[model samples]
Target: MNIDPHKLTPRARNALSRAGLLGQSTRVYELVQSGEICYLSNIGTKTYRELCRYFGVRCDGKYPARRFKPVNAVYLKQCIHYLRGHGYTVIEPSQSHNQ
Candidate 1:
């Protein structure tokens, strides 16, 4: 089954909705299959990360790497590993169809 962006945290969902990416033109599954999502005015790095986590995809190259504290790195790595193990497709921002 495809991941659901709506499953993201409330703050992230609000950001996405305001950005006109979520619940607007493209469905989350279509966005995933296309391998990218357009960047909007309010879709910042934090929001992007939340989207990545929600859709079970990793960020490719367009967005800068998020800097986590040393202690958090382990946790983040674990999360990534978990996502990958579950078979999520990671994509880049440049690949967004709307772009």
Candidate 2:
């Protein structure tokens, strides 16, 4: 399917870039599929620091990678469902969808 990045807002572009970039990986795969929805696979941000530290991997650290979970209603419901299902204490909105 063809998707338009320009249609997204600046904030959404940032968040989706992270998640969609991860979804582009040959080595990595999506945990949950929601049509064209985005998900970050335990991977940290691809910043220089994150590259040196997590290397797109998931692990415990002070500067851990974050996912894009929108505070908006539709995305909020989805993010909360996953977080709650998995048992998270502090239910914050997502950038990682589940980070």
Candidate 3:
């Protein structure tokens, strides 16, 4: 079943866009093929799990109700490098995580 990006929440679509995974390059394939959604800049695990559920993607994890925080800046930097190698034009965030 092909999941349409338009069917997902605006936040989810934007999340995929930020990760360079929207459009023809949506990693929905990767999600289904690899069973993993690589961490993106602004997307958190909760949003991710929600997106997964909407798309019927099977990922291994537990999602208990709790406070949701933003993605860690350090982790996003790590993902930036990995995504760049995949032909993604990822911009390094200007705001320092230190502050």
Candidate 4:
């Protein structure tokens, strides 16, 4: 479980850095349709794992899905904050929903 920080991608490194910042950080986790269902893009394994751990959600393969959104809704925006903070482009639904 000891991942070399330098070995990770910049996005993953950034995600680890923001692990503590997500608590109580609401920033609107948006939705993007991909493959069959909506999923979070630009999020590496480390980022996804960190988010799930912080949100108290199990890694059931649904963190980025529309169903498992916003860490249980109620406007607890955290994913978007991380995504935006990293300056990753948001997958626009209008542009390509089923791509």
Candidate 5:
């Protein structure tokens, strides 16, 4: 699968920025270190589902689905950890080192 940076919507971009993940690859890892997120081993690429569950959203899909609106910041942090444990590495912002 290929990921296109340009395909990311403005909202997604803003979310990434707020999470301090903008223009970086290790942001997910950083979020984990911050104690703002947790990882679950069975979700696979459905990290979003884990987040939705965290927010108490229920799914009506046959395969067990959940929906979350506007995506919560705290949930996104959880997603970062989920992604990291699944072999996705996030890039930390350069300035994060000084702080």
Candidate 6:
């Protein structure tokens, strides 16, 4: 399956944006390069887990609730990248990425 680069779904974009991931293209690129953000294979889009790993947040699986907090744009980008890398393609707002 081929993915059209021109169109990205609203849901996909929103997921990234709400997580503080979307913004000026250059800033996004820079954040990605600094290892401040990463793509996650499990969570679909840029997720808090990636950021946690980046920030070295300790977790013993005792508190799942505390796992997500202080989420930022950098983490969201990682989620998007993660989804894309795992054979998921962003098509349109109404359509889901094919894995």
Most lDDT-accurate candidate:
3
lDDT of 2 by residue, 1-99 (tens): 233445434443454465444334332223222211222332323332333222233433343333344546677677657755653322344456544
lDDT of 5 by residue, 1-99 (tens): 322346555444444445445455344434333323223222222443343333334433423312221145566567766667655554422344324
Candidate 2 TM-score versus the reference: 0.27
Q: Which ten residues in a row have the lowest lDDT in candidate 4?
A: 28-37
Q: Model 4, range 1-99, lDDT digits (tens) per residue?
A: 344456645664565444432222333122111211123354544566554444344555644454444443324245545555665444433324333
Count clashes in each candidate, considering only residues at least 3 apart in sequence or on different chains: 0, 7, 0, 1, 7, 5
* Cα error, candidate 6, residue 4 (Å): 11
For residues 1-99, what per-residue lDDT tens digits would candidate 3 score against the true structure?
544777878887887777656665445566533433533346556666767677666646563211222267676566667766776554465576435
Q: Order the candidates by lDDT, highest first.
A: 3, 1, 4, 5, 6, 2
lDDT of 6 by residue, 1-99 (tens): 222223435443454455455544454344334433333222232343333343345433433322432245566456556656654443222223222
Q: Who wins the TM-score comparison?
A: 3
Give the worst 10-residue stretch by lDDT in candidate 3. 61-70
All candidates: TM-score? 0.41, 0.27, 0.51, 0.31, 0.25, 0.26
Q: lDDT of model 2 at residue 16?
A: 40
Worst 10 residues of 6 by lDDT: 90-99
Task: Please list the C-alpha lDDT of all candidates, in the order they appear.
Answer: 0.49, 0.38, 0.57, 0.42, 0.40, 0.39
**Candidate 3 local distance difference test against the native:** 0.57
Q: What is the lDDT of candidate 1?
A: 0.49
Q: Candidate 4: lDDT of 43?
A: 54
Candidate 6 to native Cα RMSD, angstroms: 14.6
| RMSD in order of candidates | 13.0, 13.7, 6.0, 9.5, 13.6, 14.6
10 residues in a row with least lDDT, candidate 1: 90-99
Q: Write the per-residue lDDT of candidate 1 for residues 1-99, one digit (tens) a residue.
A: 533455678777776565445554346544443333332334556665666667667766455333221135456456546544544332322324323
What lDDT score goes with residue 51 in model 5? 33
